[model samples]
Target: MLGFFKRDKNKIAKDGEDHTVDSMDLLGEKAETTGKEVKTKLHFPPNVEIGQEERYYYQFLNNELPLLKENQISLSGIEVHSAEDGTVSVKAFLRNSLPKGVRIAEPITLLLLGPDEDVLARQEFNLTGLGELPAESSTPWVYVFNAKNVRVKEIPQTDWKLAFELKKAKGPHTLDLEESWEKSLADTDKEKLEQLVKTIKPPKPGEVNFMGIQSRLDDAGALHVTLLIRNGSEKNVKLEQLPLNVEDASGEVVAKGAFKMEALEIKANTSKPWTFIFPKELVLKEDADLSKWKAYVPQG
Candidate 1:
């Protein structure tokens, strides 16, 4: 299913070797604890192959299946403690069940949320620092939070939810283009697409900017928004799904939804347009004045 990373085995082998050294440095520099430390362990199953074509469908089955029966990422044996100087220490065991070839390129965003679902503190933990794991092997991770860094008023005793967001490192496209889209393009366009894929570079965070946003009502009274996004980054960006929020003048979120990009891929240093149609039923407020609302991509 993932064919992009295999294009150049020799190059990947070299990269893999370099990854080991990078992992060591990353682990040592990040996720170090200061106060009292605790230990724990977690076990995970192997990555499952369900033969599903759609990504979301696979994700649904992955989440709903029993932990023992499913090949999945698992976390357990979490321990947290606070020192007298207000430093907080956290430790947890993690097991990765993702395909053996896949490697984490970025630190996973860890969010501690309050009772009202507000984020109390956000931190990033680097799993790549531990290097690649053999399918079901376990790895322990530690995180230290200084009192001056986090926004939490006090150490959380209970009633907190930990959320994790993982982003893979920039690599070749794993999946092929949709058959319908490929068939629609001319031979020359197809060649250009392939060439772009080979030469495109990765953009920095916040490099993608919005040029314009316009909203309209469809015949069925659905809200459709047209957005012009400029790719200011050095590499192409795949925009299959984009999570965004629209807030009012007072900073209250009036509407939120993920927009599916029809074009799918945005070439580096170029501008592309995407249209999102929100069903009337999904509108959070009936009289939401979207005209003056500000739109932005929310950080995880």
Candidate 2:
């Protein structure tokens, strides 16, 4: 019952192609391609009950756009709006080529990049609002990157691109960036995260691993331990609770605790860091050698 205007296939940017989007571009259906840009106006069905904006989008997806092949999904950035406060919003389309309908209810990351493929902003979103997507159909949404979300010191006003920054979406050791942690990362911290992926071992199937990064003793003698929680499983997992043991270089239990979590999602094949504080009462040894340390689930 939805509709969209047909998109010019040639107009869609492919890899190594120019992807700058602007209002000047035509959104017409292609009837005959005789080696020229054609803006064929197609009549709309009277039965469509959606808004004019949605009607145009459906026209783009159903008639103007080419049929999607097997297992192919396409995302196109149609518009970009930048605010004086450095906040940006991008309107994009998500299309699927599957034979059957598809539904997604998970957290997804959106990456905005420059013409040279440098990252500009990274933001996380929930797919609950996407609803159900029919096969060979597209849905449009606006992704906003507020000042806190933008990562670069300079933002090119034009010629920007959009992409999904999935945990497993990108190949090995590229960037283990999740928006929550990414915002707090310093230049040195980012370099460390990039390097860690290369050296971090792959987690076993259906398992999550917590690798120790560093630990410190506060003035009050509480131990704060930072760890990288890496997920190597084929599926995304959520953690609701955590019972941990912190061991020293000599395999001595220096810190131990059970902590509650807010249903944290450890996306497939991504590594994220978190810190755990062991109160002075939970610290078994005040003088534990923490030069080399590790964390794990305490065996019964």
Candidate 3:
């Protein structure tokens, strides 16, 4: 047999916690006398598993008539006026007894259906403790929104359908948080290793004014090379003080030379130029070529 509408047995018990109020037992209309106060009490079913040690956000939605004149709502927490046995006093005036299984600290949302099946008002509320006391001097557990602000509008006497909904929030991510901490330490270690390696490196070779071999042969096989060097340092770095080297694809030094400059201040973001040419004997079309060669600019 297939069931058209099936309910989760676990969720059924949870839903029972939100709908503890009985409308018939509560007041049908506003109180007549000013300064007159009424007390309402609610209870939960036995053997229900409602948590109490944590805070939960809640709102009370009234869709039938305007619960509040304006949209302003606030719920602090339920105050205990008095308590004994398994009953407690709530300041809200109700015309009926509340439904069983209403536990404290659970998030609850109220939905009131408007005319033509429209949703009039939707609000959330949270309960925070067990209502198992009947003491008259006690207060209801704190509700987040202002109950006085919630009221029915003065339209006309019409029946409104109401229901409640509930949901929970997801917990924090712990695994990713741990990985972030490890990655941070790894970056710091890499930086330290770079500094240590640079400290023991040899100083660059002295600079030469102009080191290049101008070939008279234009055999397409002749080495045609151009090098533009920049001294990216704050101090004045002369070509005579630069330890420069050029290596081809075979790790062979195609040209290693230095140069001289007019004691130029290699101010930050500035650089000089260097041009080098290889001998025709070391230059080749396949086995030897400057195209695969490279220049290394050591960091000071």
Candidate 4:
């Protein structure tokens, strides 16, 4: 895992007050509908652990959306409508399962998928701009995707679905470091690595991003380069075999190698910093520019 990671700054939920806010209150200021609304009610399984008083307060919400499942964030009653402004309007009830209230300000991407699961369009939204979300309750909201984000010019009237681009983890790590790397790392290098984590943006789901740490031309005619590999997906990835081409500032290949991964597993939502050795025999250019270089997969 990327050990020298920055601390997550997500705001915590507030506690210590009894309040009586309607389930539909969060949606008033946003998700504005110009009449002609087609809303649907969802049925959910009951969680007996909910106390009576809290249950009573949520009774109205329960009739519309199922009780928020334990440790799960789900969307229900997704409806698509034509906007008066000529954009696509998507309304859905976002159900929060966390026991405590939370605020969502992160850049969230919503995808419009076709009936065959093809992505029609995607747009990013910040929920904090809309409003705060209560704990274990379903809140309704409308997302509008503009023309640029929409791929297909002719929109499909039916059989389309709206969903989150990627699922978020329940409790994300606050600089989660793998055990082995933490032990042998030096203080100065650790600080630099931490800064790298903060400086380099993370990769999207299912993709791996690499940042060069150090590149030097060895006296033995080899090029040794250290890299930080980031995996931003929700599922663990095992590198079976990775073939990479090392290119310098001129976009000229300096070194190339195929690695045999004996055992390299990058956990979900983690980054791993590693050093790859391009042997002297494999080094194609000895005088390649090391100041600005990149490592990428070679194309056939």
Best by lDDT: 2
For residues 1-300, could you state the per-residue lDDT of candidate 4 as single tens digits? 111112123422111111122222322222223333222232222222434543343344446443432444555434555544457666555665544455665777778777677887889887764455555556545567886787775556556666665543333311335566789888787787777676666677677667687889877887888777787777677787889899999889999999887667777766777778889989998789877899887778
Per-residue lDDT tens digits of candidate 3, residues 63-95?
111122111111211111122222212222111
**Which scores better on TM-score, 3 or 4?**
4
Candidate 1, lDDT over the whole model:
0.49
Question: How does each model score on TM-score?
Answer: 0.34, 0.44, 0.21, 0.45
Clashes in each model (backbone N, CA, C under 3 Å)? Answer: 2, 12, 64, 1
Return the candidate ranking by lDDT, descending: 2, 4, 1, 3
lDDT of 2: 0.65
Q: How close to the true structure is residue 251 of candidate 2, measured as C-alpha lDDT?
A: 91
Tens-digit lDDT track for model 1 on 178-246? 456566768886565566534555234548765334776566656666555656554677877788766
User: Which residue window of length 10 is worst by lDDT in model 3?
Assistant: 54-63
Model 4 TM-score relative to the real fold: 0.45
**Which parts of model 2 have CA positions greater than 4 angstroms off?**
1-50, 57-67, 153-158, 169-300
Query: By the lDDT metric, which is better: model 2 or model 3?
Result: 2
- Residue 244 of candidate 4: its Cα lDDT? 82
User: Which rank order by TM-score, best down to worst?
Assistant: 4, 2, 1, 3
